[model samples]
Each structure stands twice: as C-alpha cells, then as structure tokens.
Target: MKRFATLMLAFALVLGAISGAQAATIKAKGQWAFDFSWLDSGDFTSQDDDGNSDDDFSASQRFRTQVDVIASEALKGVVFFEVGTTVWGRTDGALGTDGKSVEVRRSYIDWIVPNTDVKVRMGLQGLSLPGAVAPSSMVFDDDVAGLTVSYAINDNVGVTALWARPVDASGNEGSDNNTYDEVDMFALVVPVTLDGFKITPYGAYASVGKDANFTGVTNGGAEFLSGMLSMTEFANGAIDSSSSTYDAWWGGAAFEMTYFAPFSLKMDAVYGSKTADDDAESAERSGWIVAALAEYKLDMVTPGILAWYGSGEDDDLDNGSERMPSVSPTGWGVTSFGYPGSVYRQDTYFGLNGAGTWAVGLQLADISFMENLSHVFRLVYMKGTNDADVIKNNAGVRDAFTPGNTYVFLTDEDSAIEVNFDTTYKIYENLSLVVEMGWIKLDMDEDTWADQDFSDAKKLVFNFVYDF
Candidate 1:
C-alpha cells in the first residue's frame, strides 16, 4: 500500500513537470456522472420463491468520472475513477471494502510513432481478447502495467500486440499459494474487413515461473501481481513452488456483419488448452466455447437470437477432454446475456467444468415506441450437453462448488429457462435512465445431492446516468 502511494506521488510530480514545460497547448475533456434509482432485491437463498417477496422501493446513488488528455497531437493520457454504491440484491458499502470510496480505474499514456500509423501505450492499461464487449471475457481483462502497440495496415485492416507482467514474485499477496516468481502475458490480434462483414482473430499466451515464489527472496521478486493466477483459471488451482511454471494458450475469432441492411450479426468462438507443468499431474485441462448473436431490424421492431455452447468435462477426470473451462479472473465478464437460460446471471452455470452446457434465446428490441426510449426483451433456455458429474474444483467463479469455496453453495445438474427485459430512456444529450429485469427458474436439479435444490431467482434494477 505504501509503495502504491509513493508511485502515485511520483506520477503526479512527473506530470506536473511535463505540464510546466508544455504550458502552451493541452486539450482535455472528461465526463462526470451521477446515478440514482430504485431496484428489486431478491433473496433466493432465503427460501422464498415468490417474486419480489422481499424488497425495497428506495433509490440508490453511484458516481463515476473520467478524463482524457491530448498533448502535442501525438501524445495522450487518460484517467478514470469511480465510486461504489448500494443497490439491488446487496451492498458492498458505498465505501468499498478497503474503506476507500474512490479508485483509479485507469491511467495510461499513448505515444504515436513519427510519420507512421503506429502507436504505443505504456502504464496502467487494460488488455482483453476479442470478446471484450461481452459482459464477461476470459484472460487479461483488468487494468495493469503493460506495453501495447498497434499498427494500421489500411482502412479496414489493423494489428495489435501486447506484453504485460501481471504479477511479481515479491508481493507476498497470495502467501498461502505463492508459487510464481513472475507472471508474463502476451497476445496479438488482426482484423480483416470485406464489403459486408469483418472478421477479427486473436491469440494469447501466458507463462509463469516458480523460482521466486517462496521465502527469503527480498530483492528478487516483483510486487502487486494481484489475482493474476485467475487468468490461467483453475488450471493454476494450487500453486506449488516445487512445480514448474504453468503454461497455457488460447485462440479465437470474432466476426460481425451488417451488409444485410437492417440485419446484423456478431459471433465469437474460442478454444484453450492448459498443460500440467509439473510431473505430479499427468493430464491437461482444456475447453472451448462458441457464442453468437443476430438481429434484424424492421419498421417497428428488431428480432434477434443468441446461442452459445461451452464444452464440459467427461467422467474421465484423468484424461478425456472437452470440459468447457472458463478463465474468469473477477467473474465480472459474463456480460453476454445467454437469453433463454443461464444458471446464474454472470458467467458459468451448473455444468461449466465437466460435461459442458448449451443455451439458446430470442431477443426483441426496438426504438420507435417513444421519442427517446428503447426496449429489449428476451426469453432463453439452457441445459447441460453431457451428463458427466460436475467437478468439485473448477465449476466457475460465480456458481462455485459447495462445502469448498464458501462463497456459494450450489450443486447443480442442468436445465433452466429465463426471461428478461431492459429499457433505456434518454432524458437529454448527456443523461439517460436505464432499467433491467430478469426472472430465472431451475428446470432440473441434482436428484442425489442433499439440500441442493435451488430457489427461483429474479431481479430488477434501474439507474439514471447523467454527466456534465
């Protein structure tokens, strides 16, 4: 903590000095936002299946702001900060768990190469693969120190590359599982466009070293590699200094099309593999997922469909592959709504690890109902693709194993149906009101598991977002 403060101080000082030297020209613009709204909080685990059985009708507030800096037309910087709040379902205290209400979410500088279509960014930055727009994504989604570069090949083609050291061996952050000397990550992506559609393919590689993960290594380790292991997912389950560094790789494709006029489509397909670095474990864990969405516009409304399939593990815990493992770092990326069915709201459901699952849903959206209003409604259904029993360890971050993670207790089989609705109302050029609702019911359960039946789940959330 002390080191973080000192580093921030140095950063401010350097920026101040630069401002003094370039006193002539600097451009800046940023957004200041405040939101307030009421919500329906559900206590599914509280034994009530009735909708809105326990609820409050009062509003809540949350705040956020961001600023961008442009210097010399070739150099730029940005900073983003936000505060927490109480809302539907739960409260993390308006004052965050760390007793700090404000956090620096992003801070970075961009430098453009002279006379070329190349730019480089260094400092606290965010990295992600092609599926970043989804509510959830796999590896390297958080903000961290790294170097990212991009080059434009033409109007519809471009390439990007990044290298980042997410964890240092010296932090002692995960003392109990400290088994990495350094965690390094690298990735590259390219986009090719045709007249009607564009396709983007990306790949990433990560490797860890077990050398400086132990005691008595003061000057040899790095610091502040917080939660980097989640990047490799459960594959890094228990860190052991005696084991070799874990290694993994993933590749995927993202494509979008709008050539069909009022029709549009987007899709992502990814595959990943993790090798057991130490001889103690004689097998590898791998998974794959495919998600896609297509919407067509008409005079009054637009209709769409979304579908996804994630592989699951077979009974062969020692060898057979196909478990659609998800590498969730903070469990925030599962933003893509599965439509007809998803166990929980976030990422992964009942059969994420072993014997994968599949979901499909239909969506209806339109903006012609009112002056500045838009609505989206959806219905979905999901279930496990294979009947292989669930794994005890890597069942996703949200729907974790029971008597194990202590964060959640859900031993699920498969089968579910979901209905959801979201509406946005624009109040002014810089203000809007948004509301979202969902209802979920489990269609299947683990007949053999004791007291594992899940209650029906539902939620309603709405907030106003105005900025100046």
Candidate 2:
C-alpha cells in the first residue's frame, strides 16, 4: 500500500509540474507488439541420460509494449522516460506470468550547453558499444547511473566520453551476493567521414566484480546430480583468494566505404583481454571477426551477404591451464533461443569461452516483393565450423574420447543450416501483422546420444505490432 501511494504521489507531481509549465511542446511515442511461435519440438535435447525423450511440440504467445515521454524546452531541460511491460504469456519456459508488469527501461535528463555542441546526460540510461555486435539485441540495456559528454570537433569528426556504475553492482537490484561493491565502465568513440567513406575507432574499459568462478563440464551420460558432483572441482578453481576482482578491456574499429553509387562495403573488428586485478592468476583472451557486405538499392529491395570469423577462447580444463572448448549459446553450431534477458547460458560462470580459438560463418539477408501492399519479406542463413576435440570429448566420460568412442552426440561437428522467411503486412493505419517460418538442419554422420536418428527441426512464428 505504501509503495502504491508513493507511485501515485509521484504521478500527481509530474502532472502538476506539466500543468504549471510555460507553453512548450511535449512529445510522446509508444509501441505495442504481440509475438506468437509454435515449435515442432520444444525438447532440444538435454544432458541427462534417462533415455526419456525431451523433445515435445509446444507453442507460445507474448505481448510487449513500450512508451517514451519527452518534456521539451518547457521544462528548461529535456526529461525523458521510457517503460516496457509484458502483457501476455509465452509457452516457452522462459517468460513468467505477465499482466502489465512495468519496468523502467530508460530515464534521463539532457542539459544543453547554449552554443557549444556539448550536452550532459544523467540518470539511468543505456550503454552500448559503437559496433553492431554489442547492440540491443545481443546485450540488453545495462541500467546504470552515469554521465555522458559529447563534443563536435568538426563537421566530420566527433567524440564522446561516458562513465557509468552498473546496476548489478550498485545494490539497486537487491541481490544476496553483494561481495563486490561497484562496476566502472568507460568508453571513447571518434567518427570521421571523408568523401564517400566513413570510419569510426572506439575503445572501452570495464572493471567487473569477480566473486564467482566460471566453469563448464560435460555430464557425458550421467544424471544432472552426478554431473553436478563431477563439475564442482572446476568451479572451485576459478576463484581468486585476494581482492576477487576481474578486470577486462576491449578495443575495436569499424569502417564503411562506398566505391560505387548505391553500392557500399562494411567491416568491423574488436580485441579483448580479461585478467585478475591482483595478478595472482591471469589469462589472455582475444578474437576478431571481420565481415564484408555489398548492397545495391533496387527501388524497394535490398539484399546483402556477410562472412565472419572469431577466435573464441579455450576453456580452462586444468588448474592454471586452458583447453580449446566450444562455448554455449553461440559457440560451434548452437544458436541461442528466447528473448533478451530471458535467455540462458549453458555454463554461466566457468567455461573455455575465454581462450582464443577460431570460428567462421556466413549470413545473407534479402528483402523481396514489396509493392502495392504495406508488407516486407526477409530471409537469413548462417553456418560455422566446429572444434573436433570439443565435440569428441562428449561432456565427460573419458571413454567417450577414446578411439572406440565413435558414438556421435548432438554436439558433434556437422554442417548446420537455418532458413527463415518472414513477412509483415499493415492491417490498419497503426497496426500490422507479421508471420515467420524457420527451419534448422543438422547433418550428422552418426547418432550417438538420442537413440532417435538425427534429422532436422522446424518452427513457425507470428506477430502483431501497433505503433502510436
């Protein structure tokens, strides 16, 4: 009751301030989306060896809405607030019961400096890397109380600096594990444009609290309880006795150029390092992915292809030693399922993901047939190389790695292919309908784990969006 009263009081104050302000423009925007999906088999396969099939057909539906409010010059300084909520249930195990549960996604105040190209922003906001890799889809909004400053050196070159305290370490989220007090992140970005070419060089540093260790172990055919017992040792080894701090830094550059009219190329690369603050234990991890894309505008159609490679880090299998292992959710041939924040990592803390190894893949997206109707269509495909040692080990049974251990598990190296078709059509002036179909194939030489023969999987999804 007290919390509700406080909220009501706050809303009243906002309304009163708006009413008393001088005549000035205020702007507001909102979006509401509903997504539905049906899976041929919800059971993707588990590490348990109970011989019980985990694959089962299932479907889900979800509704998400976001609202943004901006108070213009009437308030002297611009104040913005954004909130999001889930309005429906999803069959996927990830989403919880939903009915207007609102969360603040962004709330900040921008103070403009008269004639200079400088502004100071404070309050909870989003921190994003300049590159597309770390965009909203991959890394959700990191709620932090921070300050940002930007300067326009010239028409072509601009710079920005930011510092923030991550919400996780700020005790704002209310977690029992509060051993680490705070996290500090800083980044610098400089963008320049010359003729038809543009380049941006960026650098970022972050000091993350390290109270736990990251470990990954395979259960082989063992039950979940047995696998947990065997994996305890690896988890215990990743902890540092001293200050318990993990320091990480990353730097990268991106370039885009247009050689011919209507045709352009894009590429980006990043390198990163993670080490303990006290130096009692340290590991060097770095990888770079490069992609080249070409696009030609044909009225309303745009198509492009991309090729990329990453040297993923190896897992630390032995104390003070590391082995090249495939990471989960994104390593080898696995693609993460579920939406942002709800997604789960195979191994949360300890894994061989920090060791530098290599992976190559390609992707293609095209927009076809958009005319007369308010609809657009798109298609995408991707593939990558797999690690032999990582796949052969089969999660733990030593015998599984022997020459006779020819049983190929679901993690075995094989070509993975995914095909997707999506379309969106306007139903009204502010509402639209979306439909999508996706198919995945894993061409394996032999089946080792699930007695069932290996083949392919398919899924279908639909969505409706309303904009205001």
Instruction: Show how many residue pairs clash in every candidate, following the order shown.
Output: 22, 13
Clashes of 2: 13
TM-score of each: 0.75, 0.67
Best candidate according to TM-score: 1
Looking at model 1, residue 35 earns an lDDT score of 31
Alpha-carbon error at 142 in model 2, in Å?
4.5
* Model 1 stretches astray by more than 4 angstroms: 1-44, 47-60, 85-99, 132-140, 169-179, 209-242, 280-283, 324-355, 391-400, 403-413
How well does candidate 1 score on lDDT at residue 93?
Answer: 45
Relative to the true structure, candidate 1 reaches a TM of 0.75
Tell me the tens digit of each residue's lDDT in model 1 across 374-447. 88787877676544254433345324333223222222365667677777788897777767676666644454
Per-residue lDDT tens digits for candidate 2, residues 48-167, read: 445655433333333333333444531233333333223233322336643343455567777667766687787766655554322221111244568888888988999888887652
Runs with alpha carbons beyond 4 Å of true place in candidate 2: 1-24, 46-100, 132-143, 168-179, 212-243, 280-284, 314-386, 390-414, 443-455
